[model samples]
Target: MEIAIGVVVGAILAIAGFILGRSSGRSVGLSEGPLAGSPETDDHAALEDRSSSRESELNTVLVEAIGRVSAFLKTNVRKPLIEAGEAAGADELRERIEHALGALSDIDFFLEEPSMSRSGQSLVSLVENVAQEFSGDQDVRLRMQLASSPVRAVVSGPVMMDVLYLILHNASRFGGDSTIDIAVQAIDGRSLILVRDHGPGFSDEALQRAFDPFYSTSAEGLGLGLPHARSLIEQMGGQIELRNVSDGGAEVEVSFPSS
Candidate 1:
């Protein structure tokens, strides 16, 4: 009987030892499993996050491009069509549409990335060319005095075009019988371009507030042209100022640092 009891006890101790060893082995395996897979899983998750961020950035750029295109179409193409439909002569309408499209194309070209400063010089040339084109027909003469020596500066092509367009348009529209003059010169180690129009001059107060965003004297203006020009000039580390001449005119002076 005693020998049998001792045998039973020994058997129970062996069984308990086996179960404890199995449990310890399972605990050790579980601890190492996550450690073995964690690095790869973390790497995959990081890649996914980066991909998502890139997609979002791409979408934002696409949306901006689409919006600009839509705006151009609406303003240059659609609005003109609607307005011209009610007018008497189709010739005037056609001319207006052509001019609008040309201006819009110029704006689009300038606003694209990889902006070339040469584009600004090209724009000045284009303005002179246009003036020469209509020089014989128009009563108000346009004159350009570009720098004999190249005046190179880092500037956004589109914004420069806009500035030129606004100044020229204003000059042509309001310059009664006087000729519009443009002079590009170097001043204080910077490039200074001045557009002078012999139109009704503005008050000193107006000159001070002229560059403020959304400020305009014209009832029909979008009140963005001058302000936008100023903003762009400032962005390129330049400055613009407006002044009234004693000879009944206004002058827009744009200054840019040499590249």
Candidate 2:
């Protein structure tokens, strides 16, 4: 299954590159159908139109591929790996695999273009469910300050769960052995989820490019967590912010369109 996944992902990546090559006005010498002629032969307007369409298609491919692949790894690979750690070396290997699996989530977010549809899930309940996973299966201690009132957001429940997972995952991974703090608030027209971690906090450079793809402070990661989170949130008609708290640690606030 792993080998099959690799081959499939590799082929999709190659196709994405081919589409990218065409979109960027560099042909890979494919002499077939719409890809036969060089850009110079086409009128300026037609070239722009075709390139735009190809780019859109490429984004769709990326979003679909990453989502499906990530889901498969989570169920088939990550769960077993997490459950079978009997040695220090095995733990290290599991950590590395987690980082790779995490990259897929980030890439999926970066490629997602439009806002996700609301699945009519209660915001408070959805967050609590995700929090339970973190505290139980992941063994990450969490302190929750949930809202007294139930709120509904205009966002997809599954995607929002992924977003919350990435946020909490980053907090736990970087926050060392400290307990992460979480809060949900509904105020005015927005519903917010705030997560704080008692880590060393972001360096000056991290604060600047924390949302840039493939930018990671740790060597084990591809650094797509925050970038993907931010991109995915923004695309969902929500806003994500990162900052260092006054005393210590990092704080992330994600606000969604709420009723």
Which prediction has the highest lDDT against the true structure?
2
Candidate 2 C-alpha error for residue 162, in Å: 0.7
Count clashing residue pairs in model 2: 0
How do the residues 1-259 of candidate 2 rate in per-residue lDDT, one tens digit apiece?
A: 4654654466457546644665564433333334446575465446556656776767885665455555555654556556655664866776767765665554444444554776556878888999987677687788999889887777878788878998999999998755999999988888899999998888899889787545567654546678677867887788999889999999999998786
Once superposed on the true structure, which residue ranges of model 1 sit more than 4 Å away at CA? 1-140
lDDT of each: 0.60, 0.72
Q: Local error of candidate 1 at 138, Å?
A: 8.6
* lDDT of each residue in 170-214, candidate 1, tens digit only: 666555545889887776678887888887876666677766433
| Model 1 weakest 10-residue run by lDDT | 25-34
Q: Please list the Cα RMSD from the true structure of every candidate, rounded to 1 decimal place.
A: 26.1, 8.8
Clashes of 1: 0
